[model samples]
Target: METVTIETSDGMPVAGLRYTPQGRARAVVVLAAAMGVRQDFYAAFAAFLAEQGIAVLSFDYRGVGRSVPVAFRRSLRGFQADLFDWAERDYNAALLAAKAWQPDVPLLIVGHSLGGQLPGLLPDNHLVDGILTIATGSGYWRENAPQLKRFVWFMWYFAVPVYTRLFGYFPGKKVRKVGDLPKGVIYQWSRWCRNPHYVSDARGRPIRAGFEKIRVPFLSISFTDDEMMSRTNIDRLHDCYRNARMERRYIRPSDVQAARIGHFGFFRPQFRESLWRDALTWIEQRTADRNQAQSAA
Candidate 1:
């Protein structure tokens, strides 16, 4: 893997890592990370896909990992980053970089959690060939698992607001939450999670309309043991992409022969043989199908 810098349309430079295949490449895969998760978290998965002949790009969204600006490193004082900036500036920059890197090859996204939802919001999303979503669901407290619902409510209504206000930013890392999150991101995320429909509710009709523009094939994987996302929650989130060809699959711990497969467990190195291999197969078949269609035309 090699480190590269990607410049967003707005002129901000973000850090990225590229994994190139040994020989000919089948496709270009973008590893879109979950909120507050660093790009390094996806490094192993990206390397695995690269070995399977796919060129992969794993990047940190602005305000996280190596992508954090020098100015914000000291403190988030006066920093005004938000979720919209994540979708518009960070993810867009990464996707644009990936697409430009291998213009002729198929461009695909392997999105985790919040990463899954933002793809539809990309204005140039038509350039993407397909998307695979993992453990992504509505962040609404009401849609969380029954056991976690109350805790989620407390986190949203009390913890997030109070903590963010007290610290100027969410001290997620210190609290052992997602990661240390920017104040703007945590505040906007809190607003969405508090709403019954999550992002759809907060942004309303215009955002829903943006989702309708997604026409690519989508494969969404949900874990039954994920305390954060119930099946209903996953469906509620994916439903925003009304025009997409979507397939939702639920995986249980028993199916994977594991004691537990929670929201974040899917990307663990241990699952590389079982779950990761299947993802490669999906990419291969999808690429073949697209090629055949193009040839037939």
Candidate 2:
């Protein structure tokens, strides 16, 4: 595993992990994990891809994991307060950096959860050969969002407005080190529930249109019981991609025979092999078409 610190087009520093196979590569995958995820969570996937002759560039987002930026004061309002632009540009820069570092390699984007929605948002800009969105979604995207976030936002819409007026900004519930999330991310996310295309900047471009422009072949893979993304998000993604070919599977945790393939299980210690088997198999079947085309050409 090789490590490097690279800057995004927006200049936010991102830490990248490159796992190269022993021999020459089959392809390169630019991986994006769920929001708040670190690169280590994707170690198993990277290692598995590398073992299979595929190289990976898995990196930390702008403010997640090892790529913590010098956060500005939280008082900035509206667009200035949103980190979505920073995060999106960081993803693009990671892909470009991967190709720049390995010019001859074929590039495939593999995004999980929020990362899943990214390639569709950016579409087939020449930097990519294809895209794979795993357990990704459009907006209000808490897979558990309906029961969890709808309630929280109902509470926050009332509770937070008062608190923000008092505290200058509402201090969000902290899970891990993402302390005091700014209201802007939440506010924008709320708007996304109605309009996923609500982007304040070009870097934070909307995917609904780009989703239609995805000319590169795409593979949208998901588990039925993903904790953060519902099956509907998967359908929405597939429907929007004009030239996409999708393979959908549900991993049942209940059946003794069914793998314990929940959203988190895909990264957990116990279910690693099962998760990789599903993912690698999907990649193999889809990319084989491209491989054959290249060979024949």
Candidate 3:
């Protein structure tokens, strides 16, 4: 594993880690993290993929983890980032960096939660051959898991607006919600969560057009017990990719012999034997398919 710096188009430095296999890699995966989740949270999974002959690049978006600038490390009150910046700038830069790093292999994205939702905003998403989304869904509050609906409603209607106004950012760490986030990000996300159309409803944004342009192979995995995303949420989000060749898998905990694999359990090291292996199989198969198609062409 090697530490890398990816400079966004706007000149912000994003911190990332590259995990390379000892032998030639069959494919390269850009491991995009969920909202407010650090890139390190996916380190073990990235390393595991490397051991299986797949190279992986994982990074933190601006205002999160290592990418947080020193001026805003103490507080994000003055930070000027929103979800759009994370998708259009940070994630796009990482994808470009991964392509430059491993030009010959198929490039895929392994997006978790919010990570999966933003690819549609990327102008260069066509550079990716495939996408594997884990625990991703539309953040429409009404479509969230039944158990979290009430709390989500409160967060969207009250807490987000009140807190963002008070602190000029969302103090998510104090509230134990997602995590500390810039005011723009939290406010924009709250708006989307309240809307059935999610990001596509963002005023003046051509978000849906971007999704419609995606024609790559897309695989989405969601757990039956995901506490934040319901079946409708998952379906609604993937439905945006109307032009993509999409495959959806909903895993029951019993199928994997686990008590419960909630919104975040899929990335736990405990799933390495079963769920992880399944993911590896899908990635490898996609890589092989892409290679065969390219050769025939």
Candidate 4:
């Protein structure tokens, strides 16, 4: 594992970690993180993939994690970051970095939550061979878990706006929601969660092109007990990628013999034996299939 810096198009430095296998790697996998989550959160998982002979690149979006500039970290209230910047700038930079690091390898993505959605927004998304999304779903309140509907509503209508205004940002750490988020990030996310189409309307107009260009093979995995993302939500989000050759998997805790494998539990070390190994196998098989197809052609 090596810490690396990727420079965004907008002249910001994004922090990342690159995991390399001992010998020749089968393919390269980029691990994009969830909203308000740091890059390091995916470290162990990246290491595991490296052990499986796949090179992995895990990065933090600008203004978060090790990428946060020292000046901004001292006074986070002054930071200006949003979901649009994450999609256009941060993910773009990470993709460029990955290409530069492994010029000859096929690129795949393992996106969690918001990370999954951002790739569709990038113009060069077709450069990727495949995408696997875990616990990724539309944040539309109507599609959220029924029991958490009221709480989700409150978060959008009350907590987000009020907290962002008072603190010059959303102090998510205080509420144990999603750590501290930039004002723009939380506000934009709240707006999207409230809408049915979810970011389909950008700057008051419909974005007609980006997502449709993502024709890569895709896989989505959703847990039965994930508190934030219901099956409806997962389907809604996956539908956004209109051109993907996609497959969806719904895994129950009992399937893995666990009492509960919630939204975040899949990355825990305990799951290394089951879900992690299975995921590696799936990635390998997909890569092999793609190689065979290309050779035959």
Measured against the true structure, the TM-scores of the candidates, in listed sequence, are 0.95, 0.78, 0.98, 0.96
Pairs that clash in candidate 4: none
Candidate 1 TM-score to native: 0.95
Model 1 stretches astray by more than 4 angstroms: 201-206
State the number of backbone clashes in model 2: 2
Winning candidate number (lDDT): 3
Off by over 4 Å in 2: 70-84, 141-152, 155-184, 194-207, 254-260
Off by over 4 Å in 3: 201-206
All-Cα superposition RMSD per candidate: 1.5, 4.3, 1.2, 1.4
Candidate 4 on 90-193: residue-level lDDT in tens?
A: 88778878877777777899999888878878756777888999999988898897777858888998899888899898888888888788888888888888
Model 1 per-residue lDDT tens digits across residues 1-297: 999998877787889999999987899988889989999988889989999999998888778889888988866655667888788887888888888888877889899999997886777777788889999988888879887896777788888888888889888877787887889889888888777767743454235766788888888988999988888889998998888989988999888789998989999888888889888888887788778878999
Candidate 4: where is the Cα deviation over 4 Å? 203-208
Q: Could you tell me the lDDT of residue 5 within candidate 4? A: 83
lDDT of 2 by residue, 61-120 (tens): 654566654553333232233445535577778878788766766778888766776665
State the weakest 10-residue window (summed lDDT) of model 2: 173-182
| Candidate 3 structure quality by residue, lDDT tens digits, 1-297 | 999999999999999999999989999999999989999999989999999999999999999999988999889998998888999999999999999999999999999999999999997998999999999999999989999996778999989999989998999998998899999899888888877789854573335998999999899999999999999999999999999999999999999999999999999999999999999999999999999999999
lDDT of each: 0.85, 0.63, 0.93, 0.85
